[model samples]
Target: MSAAATTSQPRRPRSGNRRDEAARLAVLHAADDLLVEHGFGALTVEAIARRAGVAKQTIYRWWPSKVEILLDTLIEDSAKRIPVPADEPTAESVRGYLRGFARFLTRDPAGKVLLALLAEAQHDPDTARSLHERCLAPRRARERAMLTGATDAGEIAPTLGPDATMDALLGPIVYRALTGASIPRGLVDTLVDALLRPRAN
Candidate 1:
């Protein structure tokens, strides 16, 4: 998908007491656990509510559907696992980001959730819209900014457009994950070198 999709934040309940926050966390965790345990086809708002020990209405009050709950969980989990590093050289930063992303796809629980969502998106337009607007677009914006900074600093050649650059950098890792292929060691270094290495005069 192109990076032109508008960024939309995941929905959150209105500010509330600690009890509400607790219920919210409980629902998020419950959704995550259920998806991993039962897979997406079996996941339901009823199951999530039962697992969280909250009424179904509580979940509906905050999130319209199970997709929203999983989207929130994915966003929160990904933030913790793949934060962008600051104050590093552009190439190093790109390498680190790519490495962390590789691990996320290969090893993180949320990565499985992401894959499930991607699969769902193929047949469900709303899910596809939500996934792209809320998750993928924001991430693309961040990565594009980083690449733009590298270009401005003369650390990498700007031979590719922003969207193409993103596709080139991320497509291989994602394709490998989707196809169940193992990510070979040094692949991140290879991508960084190919995409971000400074051009010699």
Candidate 2:
């Protein structure tokens, strides 16, 4: 097209996806700074905006509330992705992968953010659904594959339920996190061992 013709054409609007993503990142960074300085109880949206140097309306334009911004911040700051395994999926490999993931959550900055987000998720259904879609479901499916694969390999009882096994494996880590107990690494190892180790029937 001629430069004249190009100039005459109506300009397309900025990409909403890119703009929204930039806005989201800004809010998340703001939230992270506030959280580190003041902790969860005092990390308000107004505080986040002040730190981000954006107006509160700008933050709200991308996120509905302070909790939503915090959830996204946790996810972005996490070193690992939803399907968190670090290697190919043998049952043993999968067990090892998840243990490493759990340990990271306990020891890393992102882990603290995830714990904070989980506490918020208890009272917020929107955050709960987003967490399920963004984090929980993908990891659940990966673990499910490892559990169900054992049956196909004739290692586990085909009669056994994959869903039940997944619940058995995941339930304890979450339980310990919620219950305010010091979880032994041994407990997680035990759960993995019971689920993935070959059982003689």
Candidate 3:
């Protein structure tokens, strides 16, 4: 067969198949709603399938476990909620970006899902690794880039570094989420100020 013919050979049935794709999205939406309504410990593959109106085997065919399903949802929602900031001065961009991130945590389903996943990870090392790889890593990389830009522009002190700066900004947000505390008014501004505070000469 010609190379074009060989390359264009019928694609095998896979996750992208229309019916399966619909089922997959249904499963993800079901997982998101269930995670929010019932918390992580109570979530089950059977419950998700029942809610999605798909056979349990359908979920198993696409995702190995509930964690993977939730992770996919988190990734999708975060990407939609937290966009990369436009070209701008480092400080302004970082401030806008972090503010958006804070909003995502407080205002989106992804935030609740992430908190549940983090809690689950504390008891399961495998879950921790998967969460790190599937969700945290990409998000952190974006954070790092923002910090790196700020540092390059002399907006961040050399001593604090990106990792430390990220922790400082996220620590309170995570704490509030864990404790169910509201994100206080102007908290994002406060976080940005703390992160970008001037260092003594």
Task: List the global CA lDDT of all models.
Answer: 0.83, 0.65, 0.78
Error of 2 at 131 (Å): 2.7
Q: lDDT at 189 for candidate 1?
A: 74
Per-model TM-score, in order, reads 0.88, 0.71, 0.86
Stretches of candidate 1 above 4 Å error? 1-10, 86-89, 198-201
Write model 1 residue lDDT over 1-201, tens digit each, in one string.
Answer: 222221121356545568878988999999988898899999999999999999997687778889999999999999899975545347677778888898898898788789889989999999999999999999888778888777777667756886798798889998898888999868877877776674667
> Deviation in angstroms for 68 in model 1?
0.7
Ranking 1 against 2 by TM-score, winner = 1
- The alpha-carbon deviation from the true structure for residue 24 of candidate 1, after best TM-score superposition, in angstroms, is 0.7
Question: Where's the lowest-lDDT run of ten residues in candidate 1?
Answer: 1-10
Distance from true position, residue 15, model 3, in Å?
4.8
lDDT of 2 by residue, 87-169 (tens): 33565555665576666555555566677777777897887887788766766676677656655665544234777777776
Candidate that would win on lDDT:
1
Clashing pairs in 2: none
Ranking by TM-score: 1, 3, 2
Ranking by lDDT: 1, 3, 2
Model 3 C-alpha lDDT per residue in residues 35-133, reported as the tens digit of each score: 889989899999999999999876776677899889989888888888655344477677777777777777788788988888889999988999999
